[model samples]
Target: MTNENTAATALILGATGGIGGAIGAALRRRGWTVKALARDPAQAAAGWQNGPSPLWIAGDAMNEADVVAAAAGTSVIVHAVNPPGYRNWDRLVLPMIGNSLAAARAAGGARIILPGTVYNFEAGTTTVVDSTTPQSARSRKGAIRTEMERLLEEAAPDVPSLILRAGDFFGPGIRQSWFAQTMVTPGAPVRRIVNPAIGAGHSWAYLPDLAETFARLIEKPDRLDAFERLQFEGHVDASGTEMIEAVRAAVGRDIPVRAFPWWLMRCLAPFGGFPREVVEVEPYWRHPMRLDNRRLQRLLGNEPHTPLDTAVRHTLEALGCLDQRGTLSQAA
Candidate 1:
């Protein structure tokens, strides 16, 4: 397949997910031709498919033919595919990585951008982390991520790729996030697990901010070499108490937070969905993990972060938390 056009195109895998959807929207706003690939096209968010849309391709990232077709005529490929659950990793991560690398190679040197996480870091690290921070493969998830990076690096000899690692995400439409249905609901059973008095400084990445960062990187693909890793410290060093307070202020209510009991989580780990691997990483929630973003700030030139209150409010609104009257009346 060939094209006679000169305009750039970006193919985003996993476009229905939180980060991928945001990145797709950002790219579309930037006037790039955005092609989104997902397993089920019907599952994609509303209004993302209608009208003069960026091409929506239905495909699985693990399928070579699907990926190859999706990559055709694209200048950049964003690898955003993730397994549905923690237990699926042992079966899914490697194949997906391999297929993505193959698709990028087949695309005739398109820049491959991967959204990464802090799972590669270890416990008890005081120094702020950057691209050069020593990765400790201490946990199962961390080791899997490290191995994925290694695979990308090994394939870098023939493919141009970049990995941008950000912190835990919190933004609109993120129901599964730590602060979503778990912590923000009033009189909910899940609220008891999200104590804000733990005094841990955790990183939280807002989806829109990360999406904009990825859009900027896409515009300047030449800056990426055979392989590069970047750290985007979205928001830094905010304690759990401060975060909870900010959220409460945003929503105009006093939300309660209780400490997450590791013992209870361990007990529940035997269940299929809540695997032991999820409980094994509980230390991250209990300790501080700081990220250094000097490079990201320097590259992006002092973009203002989303204020905590505004971010929290926006998240709540997206979750329909603000539609109280209608929801309450319906329940009644």
Candidate 2:
């Protein structure tokens, strides 16, 4: 348990990213002292819109010494950093998390809050997943994700950790998301959107809502275990048409929906890049797996939720798809 001196102090490793920035802002609004560790603090400050500006600490997530130094006197460490452009994640992901675990231990039992994904579960898992779901994913990224949680479990008791696992992210300031990357193009009008649904269903998490959930759980450490995994039930698109419909509603018109080109991605897999990665995890889209939030509800009473249209509209606006004059009307 953190002492009175460290209770309100939080150190974020990826404050420029969506979930991290949101959590940093939420904590600051709650009167907690927040610090963000970045290689260039100035660059991070320019794009920071999570809640409020945090005290910038010059450091790198890959460097254990840097993370340990920045985590000093902090009761919480948000390890949300990842390799840019999904490049070098195999080489950089574990080591960076290693540093966070080390720093968390050095901070005297500080809780390390990890922004988790559904990647830990097998891509073909059709069952509704909860914290108790078995992690049997076989893809390269999935294996890496599993190992990261294992490291966290190994560090438990000494360095308490919480894995708040959720679906793919969609919100402002998100750089690495399937929503912005594949479903809709950023910095331009969304003429058409590709539905990720493939006969099954999918889940979408609003970053702001997920981050608010993190802050709520973090504020009540007594409710957390030394190592806890909570599945967040976000927007569960059961029929696989909800997201596309939401986009249409946000645009105030019936937009044409395109099917995701799985075969093209399969053909491009031989070239070795995002296509290869996508193909490797194709089973995720081929199956339905909804995250169960019973445990989360027990702790927080209710999960933070935003209306589908409102979330899509905000995301589209942030992604520069819609302008001030081109936004949706009240009756739309």
Candidate 3:
């Protein structure tokens, strides 16, 4: 697509979320006419504003009329909507997928870009997961994600759709993510396992990079026609020791890094947002999995990735972990 065509009208679902807001901003920066879709129009407009901002469409992603109205006259649709917790999956994911498909079809075959995750792969599969990795139907979350993909494929067989999957997200405005506010908060019961010897190597995706990649995919929707899956290599793949070092550098001092007991994590699973499915995936933290993005690089050409220090700094600042002197502290 030419520079002029890159600015085609695009609609993003779940625009109030961190990744969605970032993608919206990136698209607007690239000159795309962006529209943000949400369940509450007023709340979306208030939370998702970036300068002049995109059109805000308030409606449920599962509602046919709402989806239709949101997708109208749009050339691209980003299905970024997701349920708040695992318990809401059965009630939400399928319906949202169906609604998104309906909207895409109604919009006369607009490109549909859906955010995906590494959970689709089975446990103990050590290879760098790429487009062709066989999805395991073992875990509950994995099964749910696989089923969602199947529904999307069936719903829009002709319309172009892209699935960009990445590792756990950690960046600005990502309070609910596993590594960000969920684990790092001060005075919160949760804490990071700081043993460099044991917790040093883990893979995490930066939100800014993920957002930029999604924007690029929307700009070159045709490139997605030939491929069904894309994996993004995130900012850094380091051990827990390296992660702590990065955090210290970002915060400009050493901070306590204590691992939460597995027993406590299990105990809190019921009340906390953390589910049993998430605990099952904790092996990824101990053994980092590499996500090869050779195809993404080949397609998008030398895209800039956020540096480790810079990403850490941004994340800490977003979480209010930095003081005026650039020292790490608890959020007020």
Candidate 4:
């Protein structure tokens, strides 16, 4: 079916989230009927429910019956749901995905779109990862992500799964990322930029661009492998200064840059919470890694790329850092 065909329905599991919201918005703009599952539909709809607002389905992703019911008549199942606050991932991540897989099977082989992550591979792997790169995740979260992909790969024949792995994500409405929490304080004017990358070249994915990539890939599903897994080479900064420069250009000022507070995170890690999780994944920031998107380029010719300055400007504006004229807003 064509993108605007009413029959082209998508069920987004985490439509309330950053990536899911972006994808849902993109699909809606493409004329796809998008539905999102949330625990409390009424409350979620009141929030910034991500682009053009999806048809909200009231249900919890952990409930297999709920997901199965929501998957009915859906052509694409975007499995973007995850536990809240990054807690209980060990106990929650697998079961939720299992539910999604079962729902996909029940829907008679709907295409499953998953926003992939770098956690599938450890630092020992090639600094540059592609479709065929071997995965040996060393961290606990990485292992969980690796297992998630393994399950998807195993069920590919029955589900027609598509996995697009990308690096650290930064985009509008994304508040929990390194860019949001570490680099600049959200709901406040841009001040000194924090460089957590520790001189390590980090791969960054602009969410809307990545979401658009998904929409394009879905348009030509027939060309994809039954278990297609592609890499998204969004923006690769070799010296880790490119992103800083982008931020500088976006805000139109040379904000003082500071090293990330590893010592603070280390102290908080012992107390347990998001800081602990952040500390656990320090290796990624300390080491350089990038995804190779040649396979994606072969399929789509060119992946969506927003200029870093433009992307950063939009992100800061959405985060309430910049005014309409690109000047810093009053500090919160």
Q: What count of clashes does model 4 give?
A: 0
Q: What is the C-alpha local distance difference test score of each model? A: 0.72, 0.85, 0.72, 0.86
- After superposing candidate 1 on the true structure, give the runs of residues whose Cα lies further than 4 Å from its correct spot: 1-6, 45-53, 84-87, 185-193, 270-272, 323-332
Instruction: Identify the candidate with maximal lDDT.
Output: 4
TM-score of each: 0.87, 0.94, 0.88, 0.94
Tens-place lDDT per residue, model 2, 1-332, is: 22243348999988888888888887887778999998899998886766569999898888999999999999999998887755788999999999998898888988999988888888664468887788988888889999999999999989999999888899888857889988888998878888767865688899889988998899889989999999898898888888888887777767788888999999999999888988876777778888989999999999999998789889988899874434845334
Compared with the true structure, what per-residue lDDT tens digits does model 4 show for residues 1-332?
24746579899998888888888888988889999999999887898546578899999999999999999998899998888865698889999999999999999999889989888778745588888888887777888888889999999788989999988889996777889988988888777898988756789999999999999998778899999999999988888899998888877767899998888999889888877888878878878888889999999999999998889888988888764444633121
All candidates: CA RMSD (Å)? 4.8, 2.5, 3.7, 2.7
Count of backbone clashes, every candidate in sequence: 1, 1, 7, 0
Q: In model 2, what is the error at residue 300, expressed in angstroms?
A: 0.6
For candidate 3, write residues 210-329 as lDDT tens digits.
Answer: 888888777776666533678888854564566566776766666677665566666777774654645766655656567878888888995548888888778877776666555424
What is the number of residue pairs that collide in model 3? Answer: 7
Shift of residue 180 alpha carbon in model 1, Å: 1.5
Extract clashing residue pairs from model 2. Answer: 25-51
